[model samples]
Target: MNGMTRIEFLLRLTISNPDVHTAIIGTLNPDHLKTNIAAVAAGPLPTELYTEISDRLAKFSQPK
Candidate 1:
């Protein structure tokens, strides 16, 4: 997944799980780090997008 998708996935995972306190992401490049920060600043994914992602993931679990 792209950086933004990965970030949103991480944020969504944390938001879904109350037990999760924090998510630690590592990046050495300044630009990537800045982008990651921006992603966090953008806040949680919208409900529609979150549901879409969840649906997509759910498909993977179904018997094929």
Candidate 2:
């Protein structure tokens, strides 16, 4: 979704799952790396935000 940021997206993929041990991101640019680090520093998304994202994704996945 356009409203989701890189950090939120990353955390959503990693933090939501207990079996996931790590998430690897590839980036060559310094600025992009910094942003990615900051995203991880922000930690996992709150339950409300996660639920919202899940709901949005569910809607998006449905047949149009």
Pick the lDDT winner: 2
Predicted structure with the largest TM-score when compared to the true one? 1
Q: Mind giving the per-residue lDDT tens digits that candidate 2 earns over 1-64?
A: 3466866576555777566887787879999888777767766667776677778779979987
For model 2 the TM-score comes to 0.59
Q: What is the lDDT of residue 18 in candidate 2?
A: 62
Question: What's the CA error at residue 44 for candidate 1, in Å?
Answer: 0.9
Predict model 1's lDDT versus the native. Answer: 0.70
Q: Each prediction's TM-score against the native?
A: 0.61, 0.59
- Model 1 Cα lDDT, one tens digit per residue, 1-64: 3345766667655565445677888889999888777777777666676677679888999998
Instruction: Give candidate 2's whole-model lDDT.
Output: 0.71
* Model 1 lowest lDDT segment of ten: 11-20
Q: How many residue pairs clash in each candidate?
A: 0, 0
